[model samples]
Target: MPETKKFLYVNRKAPYGTIYAQEALEVVLIGAAFEQDVSLAFLDDGVYQITKGQNTKEVSMKNFSLTYKALGDYDVNKIYVEQESLDARGLTLDDLLPLAWEDEDDDWAKKDSIKVVSAAEMAKIMEQSDIVFSF
Candidate 1:
């Protein structure tokens, strides 16, 4: 029997003022519901999804940043981001949500398998996935 496609959803937008982040999170939640091996890659402005301590109230938007924190509850922990993208925006992993796996061991930096890819390297990761969706 053919294998179920290993799914990947790539987000390339910022969290606020756009629905891409919310929509991508929805896909992650839904995919986890089905017990699929789902991984999410944040690129470009999408890294903002994991940016720490966002306050949406100023704009009257609900705190959607909290929604990202819930990904662990849904077992959507394979979160990845582009290193260069984060650097371009002057963000580091320290400025964003820590890996959920680190919660169990407190060795997040060691266990962090979040792929930090360049634009060229990102293409290779995309080629590796059986199914890839972009937003």
Candidate 2:
């Protein structure tokens, strides 16, 4: 069997007004489908991608934020949100979508997938990744 490598998808853009966030989401799902060890890092304006109550009606765009909830199903559970980025945007954990995964090994218990970490911690995570995709 091929050795599984840690794949980190780093998001650094806003959720809307561009294609970066959407493209990153698609790539993450594709990577996860390949059974790679996938992790996600949200920093800078990227934190907005997972924020709760997104309304893209006026912009005539589809609101894909809720799509993040499906990541857990793909086993892409390591979602790291930068604390500094949230603070800068005056947002809290409560302001983001509640993402969780079902642990089959633990009797299918639901567990949270989001981990809010400091910028330093996020950097360490990036460094530890065998392959990092930034958007």
Candidate 3:
């Protein structure tokens, strides 16, 4: 069997007004589909991507924030949000969506996937990843 490599998708942009955020999400799902070990890091404006109550109708863009909920189904549950970024934006973990995954080993018990970490911790996570995709 081939060794599984840890893939980290780093999002540093806002959800709208650009394509970086959306493209990154699509790639993440694709990577997960290939059975790769996937992890997501949200920092800077990227934290806004998973926030709750997003209204993009005025912008005439499809609201893709809800697509994040499907990550758990792809077995991509490791989502890390940077605390400094959230604090700078005057937001908290409560502002983000409730993303969770089911643990098959634990009889399919639901578990929270979003983790709030310090900037230093996020850096360590990036360093630990075998491949890092910045968007």
Candidate 4:
């Protein structure tokens, strides 16, 4: 693989009743397929992606939540969650996507994080990206 360029997909909305989440997920997966270095940082309501125990089937909707788990298969290894968003929603790290992480890997509990991030920190990631797509 050549030196892959970094691409960041920022998911900034809820996963239901909107195409933002779905589209963002698509870009991330396909970007990886092209051999780009794809990473995702979920902020604001986007943290819902990692919310534990979702059952959208009650609303007669297909469960896209599990699609998040498949990110690794596409080689999208960087997934970030904003800590303040989780707290603002009264959600603990425990109530988030099962694959949460920290830089130090304190939990090592899942394949991905429970990694907490901040807006400014997210901006740093954005600045470093060869392409930044926000949805």
Strongest candidate by lDDT: 3
Per-residue alpha-carbon lDDT of candidate 1 for residues 1-135, written as tens digits (9 for 90 to 100): 466667889888887778878877777777787777778888898888878888877798777677776777666677778888998999887888765533455643344545566777777777888888887
Q: Model 2 over residues 99-135: C-alpha lDDT tens digits?
A: 9999999999999999999999998999999999987
Query: What does the lDDT read for residue 89 in candidate 3?
Result: 99
**Model 1 misplaced regions, further than 4 Å:** 102-115
* C-alpha local distance difference test of each model: 0.76, 0.92, 0.94, 0.74
Kindly list the per-residue Cα lDDT of model 3 for residues 35-110, writing each as its tens digit.
Answer: 8788999999999899999988888998999999999999999999999999999999999999999999999999
> Alpha-carbon error at 90 in model 4, in Å?
1.0
Residue 16 lDDT, candidate 4, scale 0-100:
78
RMSD of 2: 1.0
List the candidate 3 regions with Cα displacement exceeding 4 Å: none
lDDT of each residue in 1-135, candidate 4, tens digit only: 768788778887988778778777777766776887777888889988767788987787766778777776565668877877887889887876565333335453345533678867777888999878878
Give the lDDT of residue 53 in candidate 2: 89
TM match of model 2 to true structure: 0.96
Clashing pairs in 4: 50-97, 99-112, 99-113, 100-113, 100-114, 101-113, 101-114, 101-115
